[model samples]
Target: MSPSELMPIGVFARRCGLTSSALRFYADSGLLPPAEVDPVSGYRFYGAEQLTRATALRQLREIAMPLPGVEAVLAAEAGEASRLVDAHVAKIVGDASAALRKAADVMSSLGGAPALPIAALKGPVLADAVEQVLTATAHDPSLPVLGALRVEADLEAVTLTATDRYRLSTRTLVPSAPPGRTWAGTVSGDDLRTAACHIRRSALVRLEAGPHGIWFRTTGREDRYARLLTEEFPDHRLVLDSLGTVTGRATVSKEPFLRALEEQPGERVELRLSGRAVEVRPAGGRHPGIALPATTTGAPLRVRFELTTLHPAVSTAIGPDVMLDLRGHDQPVTIRSADRGDLTTLAMPVNPSHGPRR
Candidate 1:
């Protein structure tokens, strides 16, 4: 193409709703490079076709996707691109919720007395257990305690619990030694995740808690610490008991089920379970549906759920097959790993009148 066909950086930036400097920065970061560069004047130019990539870059950056993630999305195919963007949005929302809860706890402790010393627990097993329940930690600011991982240890095992009011997860691990006395407290979800990440680098991880703060350390590495959220965790055992008897049950392969859901177009989908197969389609529509084989043993049922809320829980399920424990359309749906009883996720269905659950 001739010089007339190539758009100057300034013109291209204006057309793409971006600043000239931003285009330059994106080019330097390899997110959106210029189509051409003048050897003498250092002027940059872009072809008309480059606008699609430029627009995508701007939109991805606006959503706070990291440069590396943006590059991955830009390199992906159409289907993969949507999946990457969805995952990024979910992470940002989760982090924002945790931050709000942490800020609230900090503000409330301004004039409180010093905290008591917390006992120390060391081992990768404990760290793994804490990480498991962190997935269910509450991200909503309204319920600050649920934003924390409840840590309880006795002589035999360490238990971790987290809930977001909508769902709950509990994990237990056998500890190397039992504390002489029980040690229980709530720690920020963000802090627990950081600890879990660091613990993986060492053979043994040590956890120490005090009235003012909590600390996690691995030999030859920098220790991590944060203020513990003193709020009381709800009686989660009672919540678990209230899950009610399962009225319907189905065990389906995770990969196929997840793929079908991903291919579905909308943010909500209706799940219809028949004798031995489940049909998934866009909520309130008949076309664009897929059926997958399942081991079902209950009455045929139809339920609608927000895909955003249901997808993550299934994506993180432990094994090849996930078991669904259903009560009714209006009730919360319980999902578990068919192989292990340790992991459980509960997702509340979308109320018919209110549309999708936020």
Candidate 2:
């Protein structure tokens, strides 16, 4: 190859987004040796053809991939390389979660706060409730509490609730053992999500609330900690109390209801309830609606909702059949299992005037 085809270390480092020292270190480590080295001058030169590999190496290092992992990724095929990167990321995330839990423990110890026993619950049941209710949490920079799950525990039951303004989901779990005392706090949703996998496998989980966080002491697995948020959770109980009486009710098979919603076109959807069926349609009359069989009572109603807000509320119901209690088009619709009342979701509907985006 011509001399012009090779770039000196300084120029090659600039092109590959790596410093000259980094290039020298990698070359010394046998990871990215230069294309050519001048014997007399003792200088390194990289060919233009090596730029792709150099760039990939830089990216892998940017993600904090260890040297061995980076080397493996650089040598692997495209699909294998992608999988390796994903595995590295998962490991980093798991490590970070463990670090945060350790930090929380350290802080509690430093502050000399005792861990107060909160409640003991079945691990599988707690895990299920966390997954279902956390669907209502939203991540917003301004209101961090919206991304938290409220834990309220008493002697009989522990209730988990989350709301993203548009939708609210709540699940009540009867503890295997009574709580030491009544307790309520907003626990970080992210932390709970990280700990959910371990929580699911354990036979039992004892919740202990500390001054700064909550600890999930499992029967056989590693204990996990969830930081407690100081922000005030939204007054969901007020909304529940203020709700008007249900004027229309419908019970439909969960599968068909979800399918109808999935097949419905546009971002905004309309539901017309009359007789023993509920019709799902695009908001702007662009397509004919599909009717699903339902058990109906009370007055007929026409309601509108953003597909984003409504689908999750119905899909998260616990049982095969879902019941919708509609007060009015303007009111929030109550969705829950037709047979079991433990899990309930409230979805706010859009105005009838809202139409599909142009």
Candidate 3:
């Protein structure tokens, strides 16, 4: 194209919603080079065709995509570009959420004073229990307490609980402890994950809680501590008790069903139990359906759930098959390993009127 056909940098930036300097920087970085340049005047020019790429670059930068990632996204085909963006978003969300949780724990600790140890438990057991329910913890900054794992211990058993309002999970383990010593506290999920890693590598683990912070120490290993969340946890027991009587039940093979859900392209899906088969399909009636054989009882029922919320419960189920206890269309569904009574995951079903998104 001739020089007359090329748009000046100023005009191009205005059309692309970018500043001239930003366009120049992108050019310097080889993201979007000028179509032509005046050697003597040092003026840059861009083709009108570059507007689409420039706008996309601006959006990618707005989301804080790294330079290399941006380049990869630009270089990819349409389908691959989408996958790249999705992968980057998932990683950043996970990392930023963890950092926020850690920062919140630190700030809470600084606000109060420290206390002495109160309870102890086995390292491996605690690690396993925490891992089992960690996925259920809420990561929302507005509700700090919900982002924590509630640790409740007594003479009989030690229980770890986490919930994201929409879903609740609890893992119970019998603890080897001295009688009459009981304790309850909420620790940030990020801190618990870190402590669990150290605890699993050690032979013994001890827990101490005070007014300000909680400490976890492993025999022959480094210790870790974080500020406890002082906000009161929701009465989870009441929520559990409030669940209506089981109106329907289904025992489905865990792996195949979980795989089918993972492979689904929609954000929300409908789960229907009819006779001895479970059918899964996109909520908006777009994709082909998947059917899996299951052992069902009580009644035929259909419910909708956000794929994000339902996948974790199915993926974490321990046994070969999982049992679903359905109360009603509006009630939360209780999912438990068919063979294990120690762990349970409850996910709230989506309203049918609100169709699932792709």
Q: Estimate each model's TM-score.
A: 0.63, 0.83, 0.68
Q: Is candidate 1 or candidate 3 better by TM-score?
A: 3
Greater-lDDT candidate between 1 and 2? 2
TM-score of candidate 2 versus the correct structure, residues matched by position = 0.83
lDDT for each candidate structure: 0.78, 0.91, 0.83
**Per-residue C-alpha lDDT of model 1 across residues 19-59, encoded as one tens digit per residue:** 99999999998888888899999999999999999998989
- lDDT-based ranking, best first? 2, 3, 1
- Model 1, residue 355: C-alpha shift (Å): 3.8
Clashes of 1: 4
RMSD in Å for all candidates? 9.2, 3.7, 6.3
Q: What is the lDDT of residue 137 in candidate 3?
A: 79
Compared with the true structure, model 1 gives a TM-score of 0.63
Clashes of 2: 0
